[model samples]
Target: MNAIELLCKARKAKKEARSEIPLHHALEVRMQERGWKIVYYGDEAGNRKLASVGLSDFSKDIKSFAFRSNTSKVIAIDSRMPAKNRRHALAHEIGHIDLKHDLAHLTSGDEKDAERFARLICTDGTIFKRIAIYLFCILCLGFGIYGSVCIAATDDPNIQQIDVSASPAVNADEVVHFTASGEKYHRPYCSAIKGRSSFATSIEDAEKNGLEPCQMCHPDIN
Candidate 1:
């Protein structure tokens, strides 16, 4: 499948799941509901990383993997990664599962489509909006095809980040903030958090605790 087809499949699966929760939580809940088990590396045998899951060389880079057998499907994630990254990895694996991508039989083209699909779903904004941006980029060739991919994948930080002055506070210069219920981290003055309950925290602390970047008031994605 191509990027558009993959994205359409993802949207269909998301609609059918219908958990009324965050995308990550909903995906996990749907997997469990379907009898698929999600486990961490330490939960199973061996103290190794992705190696224990049959991805030895990818141990350092891959965040998760999915395995399927005649009777069951299992997704395993690297517990050592930050919470936000772990969530994205899990969602990506879930994308493979939901889209029924056969790992054993996947072609190079299929693999690329799968990765692009996962990135789209894991992105902070709505799928429709992102797709619109991707299509617009394709039309405006001056931006380049790679630029289009970056937009769809949420890897273009320059486009995502907005400059907003920090709200007045003693620690405003040193701390970033995020809503208790949001995955996006933000600068103190971000209008996105204007009326919401938010907490001020250092970037290091926010990252260590696993908050993700805000699409509108982009903090670091990493």
Candidate 2:
């Protein structure tokens, strides 16, 4: 089925799931029900600074991201966005999660549908709101196409990949490292896992399991 059709079905499903609560609250409840965690970045002063420093490589235009693994799911929202826009962004990411869209590679059409789905979920579903959502999506699509072209023009071959996964279940109490089909365990933010299949584990567990430290991230030493 096409994106719109998928979105319509998702909307119907959401309505049936919790028709009484406000959309944002309903979405949050839905996420919790599915065992997904919601994290807001840039909430504190230190966090805002850290977010800006860490995400410098990403376009500031990007608002939120969703990450899913075999055992865990997380949706990180940008705390800097206006309240309404943040809600829309959260809903948009939820659309991605619910529709089973691949976060690593989303086409322009998928992005449009996701944005429209978000708007529909957030607003009162009036015709005027729908038209506005369409226009906004078109604008976003144009920006996305332009950005893709820019990235293609300056493609770099040596960029390190970071692996972010939610598998083997993480213990909130433990400091850990990650490895995906590799001999070495890496820090959660290490570039070595960029495109690799990996899961997080406690550092002690990693060593006990015979996983070595990543030379770059030095999870073993740190």
Candidate 3:
């Protein structure tokens, strides 16, 4: 079909639909209504299945193709492509069906017509397409903000880093150290604690516990 004919056909079909659906899904339903099976394959396993039933030597270069199965016509598309390309390819294959091209013979004479059909159907301005475009923009914005946050975390010199291996802050004058069995408290590193396994407490706590300063370490000097 020419561009105008294709557009009219698509618009007529859209007006007949009970409700709106995604363009790709609507295309699948369009083909399905004619008893055609649509298969979207991505991985090697899916490719293998399509190869067995449809094109055995699938050119990785092409995105989609159509074939006549024993029971019904089948359309196969490469799912690895981005959603937009995948839809375009599927629509292109559907274009072949709608245009009544010889699927088995496969000729290039009508390639342009099929391409036009795909473009018209995909770009024909629908509420679903508008919503999809808006959602895609939102997703891109979210990723941009997340990526900016990640970059700032890695590149900003102002971000503080904690030295987990360093010792905690301590006020020497406010704290005193004593051994588990000792009767007196002394400053850390005092001679009295040089060979002792000591613990620490506040100076007031030590004094309240009836502990005195060690004379040998001159603990009271601090």
Candidate 4:
């Protein structure tokens, strides 16, 4: 289906009451299924910023804007807000895309529908716990937690990837080093090292890194 059709499907599926899945989880499932990446940023500024000066209050509320010329995408989020509320806002913005709000002028009910969509997707029992963690990371970033959130395979079911990798360790000497290869994964959250064989962490002393969010994980994107 096209973007508009898929969005309509999501909207229809949303009408039914489901489990208490967070907005982030529901958007992730929907967006990922369509191969769109989600990126979370605290405030859009400087070179990292993607918003346009022409955006009005309506566009801001919509949460996403596209550059018509190049088809570049921007998903604006106020990450400084509360985590839960921020997640809701991001989800609402995503709902605009899911409901194809951009194809035409947004009606008054469009905003309300997007908000309802956010709440509906994030209900309960619909998204699994593991997926919930991913949702939490998205919300945390939206809450201004400047860290890179990534998913890794796990050996223990009880230990989620976020719990293990959210904070990477620094040496006792107060030095955080990353090899060239590992530098690619250097997120605002963790400092990773790439070796010929494996990846290791110290997990002793770590600092909250700046958020260099991913497009696939952040649901606030267009």
Highest-scoring model, lDDT? 3
33-136 per-residue lDDT for model 2 (tens digits): 88877767765753554354454233245668777667657777778879888888888898777667897788787787677667657766444233432443
Measured by TM-score, the strongest candidate is 1
Q: lDDT (0-100) at residue 40 of candidate 4?
A: 45
Residue-pair clashes per candidate: 0, 6, 0, 19
Any idea what lDDT model 1 has? 0.57
User: What TM-score would you give candidate 3 relative to the actual structure?
Assistant: 0.49
lDDT of 1 by residue, 113-221 (tens): 5665566666654544445345434433432212112221135554563222223333446566654335567875678776444444456555655566676766345
What lDDT does the true structure give each of the candidates?
0.57, 0.57, 0.59, 0.41
| Model 4's TM-score against the true structure | 0.37
Task: For residues 58-149, write the lDDT of model 3, one tens digit per residue.
Answer: 64667788887567578888888899999888878877777778887767756766775566566654433333223323333543311110
What TM-score does model 2 achieve against the real structure? Answer: 0.48
- Per-residue C-alpha lDDT of model 4 across residues 70-184, encoded as one tens digit per residue: 3433444555567776666666766776666753466776776665556645545334233433443544344433223334444557554442233423433332222211212
Please state every model's RMSD to the true fold in angstroms: 15.8, 20.5, 29.3, 18.8
Off by over 4 Å in 2: 1-4, 16-19, 45-61, 125-222
